[model samples]
Target: MTTNVLMTVPTGPGVGLTSVSVGLVRALEQQGLKASFFKPIAQPHPGDEGPDRSTAMVAQGSSLRPVEPIPLHEAERYLYNDNIDELMEEVVGRFQASVDNDSTIIVEGLAQIPGHPYATRLNKAIARTLDAGLVLVTAPNDMRVQDLEHHVEIAAGSYGGIKAHDVIGCILNKTIPGSLGAKSYGDQFARRPIFKRNFALLGQIPVAEELTYPRVKDVAEFLRARIINAGEMDTRRIQSYTLCARGVENVLEALRPGVLVFTPGDRTDVIMATAIAALNDIKIAALVLTGGYEPSAALIALCGKAMAKGLPILSVESNSWDTAIKMQSFNQEIPLDDKERILNVKEHIARCIDHDWINSFALNHEERKLSPPAFRYRLIEQARALNKRIVLPEGEEVRTIQAASICAERGIARCTLLGKEEEIRRIAQNNGIELNHGVEILDPDSIRERYVAPMVEIRKHKGLTDIVARELLQDQVVLGTMMLEQNHVDGLVSGAVHTTANTIRPALQLIKTSPDSSLVSSVFFMCLPDQVLVYGDCAINPDPSAEQLAEIAIQSADSARAFGIAPRVAMISYSTGGSGSGNDVEKVREATRIAQSRRPDLLIDGPLQYDAAIMEKVAQQKAPNSKVAGKATVFIFPDLNTGNTTYKAVQRSADVISIGPMLQGIRKPVNDLSRGALVDDIVYTIAITAIQAGSIGA
Candidate 1:
C-alpha cells in the first residue's frame, strides 16, 4: 500500500556501498520522485552517539521523507532475537509514519549481507516486508568481478542454505566508458543462467564529478535557461557562448562566434543582427534576454518564424544578466538514457513496488542460486587462481582473528598472522575466536628467513650490506612487505597500530615502481551504492609540482578505468578557468594542460571550483566547452593541503563516506590503511592488493 519505491542494496566487503547509494538517490531524485534511504546495520565506533552517520546523511540529502535517524543501538533493540521479521516490522513501524505521504524508501545494507550474524535474514525480511525490488550494487574493479560472481552464486544458493527469492538486477557502478574488458564482464554474468535470468542491467554509472564531488560547472549547466520569445538555437552553440548586456556594443564587437546576446526582448537591433547573422550563416547560436519580459507580439511572431527555420529560443525572467546567470546557475545536470523517460521511472516505481517483491526476497532459501556459502567459496577459489596469499596482520585482535578464521575455514586463502604463534593462539582461545585449521602463524622472527633475502637485495641496490638488511628486517612492517616481494606471501597489510609511513616505507623501498610509472600516487574508491567515485593524490604528494599533479591525474584516471569507472577528471582549484587568478590557479591550469596532453584519451578540466566541476550551473558559467566540467569522476586536487582538507571536510562536514587513499603507480603490492581501520579496511586492502597483482599482467 506504500507508494514509496522500496529499494534495497545488498553489499559485501570491499564494495562501494555508500557511493552506489548516493548515486542511486541522486538519479532517482533527478526525476522529481521523492525517495528515502535507510541503513539496517550501522557500525558504531567506540564513543559514537549518533545514528549510522553515513546513512543519516544520505537520508538527509535524499528526496524521500525526512525522518530523524534512529540510533543503531535503539534499532538493535527491536531486532529482538535478531529476527528478520521482527527487525523489518520495527523499521517499517518507525519509518512509515515519518516518511512523506508519498515517497520512495531506500534501504542500504552493510558490506557482506551474510558476514553479519543476522544479515542474511534481515536482507530477505526487509525485501519481503517492503515488497521492494533488489538492486545488487557492485564495485567494478578486478576484484569486483569475483565478488559479483560470488554474489550470483549466493543468490542461487540459500540465505543460510535455505532458499528464497534473490536480487532482481544489478547496477554496475563506477564503470569506465571505453574499457571493453570491463564492459565484457556483463558477458561473464550472462554465462550463469540464474544470474542471467535475474540480472537486469539498470545502467552503468561512470566515475564523474557530477556524482563524486559537487562541481560548480555542473550547477551552472543545471540552472541555465534559454532567453525566450525567440526561435530554436543549438545547445552546442550556446555551450561556448558568452553573455553581454545590450548596450555593451564594444564587448559584443569583441566577442567571438559563441557569444550570447543579453538585452530586453524588445531590443530589435540585437535580435535583428543575431537573426541576420544566423541567416547569413554566421556562427552565432544563442541569446539571453533579461528584464523578465517577453518581446513585442511582432517580435514573437518573427522569432516563431525563425524557430521554424531551426534557431532555438530560451526564455529567462530575470531582470539583469547577472541575476539571470545567478538564477540559472543553481541547478544540476541529471543524465538518464532519455531525459523524457524520467516520467517512466516514477511510474515504474508506482506500478512495480509492492509486498510480493519484498516477501519473496525475505524468506531464507538454501537453494538460492547466489547463496552466501557459494560466494565465500567462489572468492576463495578466485584467490587461489590468482595465487594470492591473504595475510591477517592484525591477527592478534579478535576481529582480525575472526576474519582470518572465516577465510581459512572457507579455504579462501593461506592466512598468516603477525603476532607470536603462542600469543595468537592464547588470544584466540581466550576471546573464543577460532583460529581455522592450518591457518599459518608467523612471528617477525620467523619471517626473517623469507624476508631477509629481499631486504638484502633492496639494501644491495642502496650500497648497503647484509647487516643493514637484518636490522631493517627486524622492523615487522618492513619485514612483512619484504616477505611479500620475496614471494613468501603474495600480499601484505599493516596500518592498524602503525603509522602510514611505517606501513608504506617498507614497500616504497623494496617494491618500487610499475614499469611505466615515474612517481606513485594515491586514490580512493568512494563507493556509493550505484557508483564508485575516485579521488586521487589526496593522500600522498602534499604539494606536487604541476607535472606531478598531472601524473597523479593520469594515474588516478587509469586506476578508475581498471576499477570499471569511466574517468571524467576535474582538476579542482579555488579559481575556475582563470576566473580567479593566483599561483594555485596557475598550478592547476598547468596540471590540466599536462594531463590532457599526457592522456589525450580522457576528459579533463582544470582551474575549476569544486561546484563547477560537478554542478551544471557552474559548468555553464565557466568552461562551457569542457567535457569534464560538471561530469568529472576523478578529482585531482591542487595540493595535498587542499586535497586532504577537502576530502576530510567532505567526509566530516557533508556526511560523505570516503573509501580509500588507495596507493597507485606501485610496481607490486603496497597499500596504506587508516590507523583507525576496521575489518572492512583490511578486506579492501586485500582486494586492492589482489587487483594490483593482477594488474601486472594486464
Candidate 2:
C-alpha cells in the first residue's frame, strides 16, 4: 500500500517549500522506509533550465528514484478551460503509474504565484483525488500572532469539506533563530485555540544561511559573464559580494574567504592586491570585472598564474553598481551535482526538525501494511528502542568503519570496534569518516589477558590449555566471541574482511547452540519489492537427515515470525504429493510430516515444487487441496545446493536485497557478513543483530 502526503505552501513563495520537502523525504528514508517524490502539478519553468526545480532537487539530494515530472502546461490548460474533472483524472492516473506499492510518495503542490488563482483549490482537489493527507508549509513574516493564526485556520479549512483528507500538521519554515525564546513555536502554537483544535504545529525550522548562498558557478551563469581565468574554483560558494570601488588598502581589509569582489577591470592596484591575497592562501570565491574592461595583457597573464592557485576571474558588461545589484537579486538554485550542499541541507534539517513526531504521526495514521522498505525501517526503530552494544571484529576495514559511523549517527545501536584505538582513528581520518558519534574503539591487546582465563575454563573439556587460549584470543574474532560469552557485548558482527569460516568458527566454539535447538541453521531475509521472504539452510548445514531437516524448518519458521514476517512453511522439492517417488522427494515428505507433528500451530505443506509452493496460479493447477501451497513466506530447501543457488539467483537476477546468513539456534547473536559486503550491507546486518539480541536477551 502507498501512503500519499501532500505538501502545500499556504503563503506566497520564498518559504523554502522545496527544501522542506526534500528534507522530509530524506528523514523518512533515514527512518528505513522507501520514500519517493511526485509533482502532479508542476510549476512554471524557471528560465531555460526546466520546470519542476523541486523534483530535480529531491532526486539529487536523496536516494529515492526519480520519475519524470508532469509538465505544467498540461494541467494549466485543463484548468484554464474549465476541465477540472479531466485534469484530476489525468493527474491521478499518472501518479499511479509513477509509484509502486512499496514507497511512500510525497506530492508537492504548485507555488503560490500570480495567475494561479485556483492553486489552493487545485491542491485540495489533488489531495482528495489521491486520498492523501495534507501538510501546510508557512513562513514567519511581519505578521502578528493573531494574523498568523488566522492564516493557518483558513489554510486548514480548505480541506474541511473533503472526505478523509485530514490536515495532519503544519511546519513553520524560515523563522528567526531565537524569536520564540524559552518555548518552541510548536508548544506556543499548541496553546493557541485555533491551531490546537485544527492541526498540530509540527515544529519551526531556523533559516539557514548555507541554503541561501549562491555558488560561484551560479553567479557566473546568471550574469552571462566570460571567464578570463577558469580553474578549480567553479564549485566555490559565494556568501556575499563586495563592490571594490574603494582604495586598495580598504579592499585588502574587506577581502575574506567566500567573498566575491566586483570592481573595474582596469584597476591594476585593486587587481594586484586581490591576487597577492590569493597567493598567500586567502581564497576568494571569484572576482568579477565590471564595465567590460580588461586589464593589460601582462596583468592578465599574472592573474592566470593566480588562477592555478584557486582564484576565478570573470568579466561582465554591467557597471560596478549594476553588477552588485544583479548579484543581490540573483535567484539561487542548487545545482544537481552539488552533493556537498545537499548533504549539508539534509544534516541541518535532520537536526532542526522534529522528526520523531512526524514519523509517529505517519505510522499511526497511514495504512498498516508491511512493505519491504517499511519492514527494514521498523527493524532500525526496534533496535533503537532499547540500545544494545554490538561489537565489530573487522574494525580496521573501511566498510566496517563507515557502517559503524552510520549506526552511531542514526542511533541504531551502540557500536564497539575491536582494534588498536590509534589505527582505527587513523583509518577513519584518512577516509573522511567521522567517529565522534559515540562509537568506541578498543585495543584488543590491552583486554585480551582478562578474557584468557574465561575462555580456557569454557573450553577445558575440549582439551584447550591456558597457553593456547591466550594465543587464540589474539585474533579479533575470537576475542569478540569471548566478550560475548562473558556478557561484555550483546551481539557481534564480523566477516567483512575475514573469511566466513573464520568468523563463524569462533562463535560455534564459544557461544555454541541454544539448549532447545538440535542444530544451527542460517536464513537470508530476501527483500522483494513488496514483501520480505525467508530462505533457510542456505548458509549452513550442507545435507541433513529427515530429523535435521525438520528441525531446520521449525527454526526457520520461528525466525521468520521474529523478524515481523508471518510464517507459512513450504518444504520444497521436485514433486508434489508423492507424484514422483524418489529419495529426495521422500526425504522432504518425511521432514514435512515431522515438522507438522512437532508444531501443530504452524501452517505447513511438503513435497512441492518451487513453482507450486510460491505461485498461486501454479498451485491452483498442481496442488489445489494444500493450504500452504500458494502463499509461503518461509521456504525450506531439501539441501544446500538448492537453497544457496535459489537465493543467490533471486538476489542477483531479480535484484532483491538479501540481508543475512543470519545464524539461528546460536546461544547469543553473532552474525557473519559476506566478504564483499557494502557499507549499507554491514549497517543493516548490525541492526538485525541488535534486534535479535533484544529478542533473546543478552
TM-score of each candidate? 0.50, 0.72
TM-score of 2: 0.72
* Lowest lDDT block of 10, candidate 2: 361-370
Q: Write the per-residue lDDT of candidate 2 for residues 1-698, one digit (tens) a residue.
A: 12455455455556677777777766665554557677787775456365356766676534455566667788878878999899999887778776755566778776677777878888878877877777778876756666777777776667672122377667777766566632465456557776534366666777777676667877888899998877655567787688999889888876776788999988888898888877755667888889999778989787766778878899999999988887666766666666667755765564455667546535444333345655676777788886999999888887898899989988999999998788887767544468975698888988999998899899999999989999999899999999999999999999898888998999988999999997889999988755678899898899988899999999999988887777889999999887999899999999999999999999889988999988999999999998888888899999999999999999999877799999999999999999889787898899999998998883
Candidate 2 lDDT: 0.79
Which candidate has the highest TM-score of all? 2
Residue lDDT tens for model 1, 112-169: 5343565555566666676665666655565445666676456424332112344455
Name the weakest run of 10 consecutive residues (lDDT summed) in model 1.
367-376
lDDT agreement with native, every candidate: 0.59, 0.79
Best by lDDT: 2
RMSD of each candidate relative to the true structure: 27.8, 8.2
Residue 137, model 2, lDDT:
81
